[model samples]
Target chain A: MRVSELVQRSGASLATIKYYLREGLLMPGEATSATQASYGEEHLRRLALIRALTDVVGLSVQKAAEVIQLIEGPGDDLFLTLGAAIGALPPYVESSNEQAQDYPLARTALERLGQVYDPDYPAVGQLDRALTAASAAGFPVDDDRLELYGAHVRAIAEYDIDHVPEGPAQGAIEYAVLGTALYEPVIAALRRLSHQDLAMRRFVPDSATDPAGS
Target chain B: MRVSELVQRSGASLATIKYYLREGLLMPGEATSATQASYGEEHLRRLALIRALTDVVGLSVQKAAEVIQLIEGPGDDLFLTLGAAIGALPPYVESSNEQAQDYPLARTALERLGQVYDPDYPAVGQLDRALTAASAAGFPVDDDRLELYGAHVRAIAEYDIDHVPEGPAQGAIEYAVLGTALYEPVIAALRRLSHQDLAMRRFVPDSATDPAGS
Candidate 1:
């Protein structure tokens, strides 16, 4: 298909498609004429992935490009590629968690959850940042609660990794990285919906109640 | 403090702070003289709130302003305010979920989770978007898995709202809004870390395994 059709179908403006092409995030198509080129299903998929990273996952274009490179270039160690892909995510709340500092609550939460204290992982820093922020906001997640949350999330993560298609390295890499970016809002939205249910049950007295559902 | 001090304290550029003042997102400081003014702690809090909304929540400046307005002006109904605040988050993967989406899987997931299938809530749209995207990506979240994930997230949400810092309406409003934005990264990070743990166990043969952790 032509660029115009790609833009129309993808719901992205022509300029956005052009900008992505220029940024090399979207690969160039077959040169059909002097200024015309053709795209395929792969282009559509790439566009969707790019949008998911930049718009949904909230990674900047540069970071998204790095993630794409990691996807396109899965090293000998797939585990290392996975780590790098996640590390490319936006560093939320640039605090001292980046440095090797004492985050006792984070440590407690991790130990209770049965997760190893691997300080080298970017996620440890993120966990530290989150725990610190929540604590600072007067809502310290106790060890038990943090452990419980971890169990549920670990199950979800397991389900996600289990579903990675048994195919080429590139396909699996795309699945892991894109799934990380895309499924987050799903998890978050469900969580928010759950919050709504709780609030509705507690505050909105007139609302219908379903204890069996919970 | 003065403008320079405000900039230094908040870590926002002078131009960015001035822009916020121009946009009326931040209230004007007390004018002490012709070309100078003084800010206070309230300004600092508001600045933090704005940064969370724009930087973390990925809300555009205009949308961030709207969220700020919602927080600033919580009507008599706290429930409604909560809805509006969550509604203000970025709509991930805009597809046909916005309308009365007849997503059978979504309906099943919601019903199994015992959540009310309200078409009006923005979160319903978000849930629909996430589920649909996941399914399209060939990782369909079946009803059983969705219900389990929902249960875990429900507990987290309950913990969050329970810790709403019982105080002024504005304070509570800020807590809810900021909590939504700030804590999402934390949740995502934790989930990712869990994924890392799972991947380490499954893929990396030499990696240490901790079954008791899960």
Candidate 2:
């Protein structure tokens, strides 16, 4: 595919694609002739991931480039690539302070889940940021609720791990990363709807009486 | 309590508290004297919610104000208030086209979950955005995976709905909204950590054999 096809297919503006190329966030396509280059499926995949990182995951270009770098270089090394991905988590999800107060709740939460309480862990840092922020907002997550939620998510995560694409490392990595990035909104939406469904059941009695609703 | 006390208690700065007041997000404090007005517990709670909205949930100040509007005015009406909060969801979390093409996966996913497939539903819109983005990135969510995730999230949602604080409608609204906003990061972190734990179990040989890890 040509650069134009890349632009059209990826739904990204030409200038945006050009910007990614200039920034080295994207690998350049094969040069066919003067001012013309051909992109392959790999380029398209790369472009899609880039757009998701910036547009969906909301990582800065610098951070997205780092992630792209790690993804391209590290094949089948999930932890090593994801370690860099964790670096992008807090800033990508929310603009939190790096030097924020220590997250005692996050550490304890991890430890209780039978995992080592590693502060350097990305999710741990993210958990700390979230717990600290929630506490700041005067809506602290209690230990019991955290434990229950932990158990529930552990089930979900096991399913996710079980289903990660096998064979190709790149495919598996893409699935894990994209699934992590994209499915979050899906999970959040499903969770919200589940809440809404229950709320309707509990509060909206009329829904139960309605023949179609049940 | 005085403004200083509100700041001390709420962890928001004076300028921020003033901004919320100026924006009418917080109810005005009683006029204690010429030089000072006294705030109360309600103000502290209101401020806490506001900070969570802007800082943690990453809503714009305008969106945050609108949420505070919905929360304060529409007590006991979870659907009505959250309907407005739904208005804030896409822009708050991920920037996606509200006018983007139709979302079949989202609708089907909802219908499969025994919920009304209302396009107007906020989570539907969010789910649509996520699915569409995923598909465009060449990782379209299949029906089986969507249903599997739907089933998984249903369990978590029930627990969350069950845990909605009893008593004041305002308090209930606060919990639902804050829990929706705050616990997302927690859930994401937990899901990620669970995947890590599993990945360690399957791939890391030393962890199983190591006495401390088990």
Q: Which candidate is the best by DockQ?
A: 2
Over A53-156, each residue of candidate 2 has an lDDT whose tens digit, in order, gives: 66666566887787777766766567867766776654233336655535567767777767643355567667776777787677788877787788878887
Q: TM-score of model 2's chain A, to 2 decimals? A: 0.83
Predicted structure 1: lDDT: 0.73
Chain B alone, candidate 1, TM-score of 0.85
Question: Which residue pairs in candidate 2 have backbone atoms (N, alpha carbon, C) closer than 3 angstroms, thus clashing?
Answer: none
Model 1 clash pairs? A114-B213
lDDT of 2 by residue, B63-95 (tens): 877777776677656787876676675423333
Docking class of 2: medium
DockQ score of candidate 2? 0.49
Candidate 1 lDDT over A115-188, as tens digits, reads: 65355566666677666655544445666567666777887888787877897887787778777877888788
Candidate 2 second chain TM: 0.81
- The RMSD of every model to the true structure, in order and in angstroms, is 4.7, 3.7
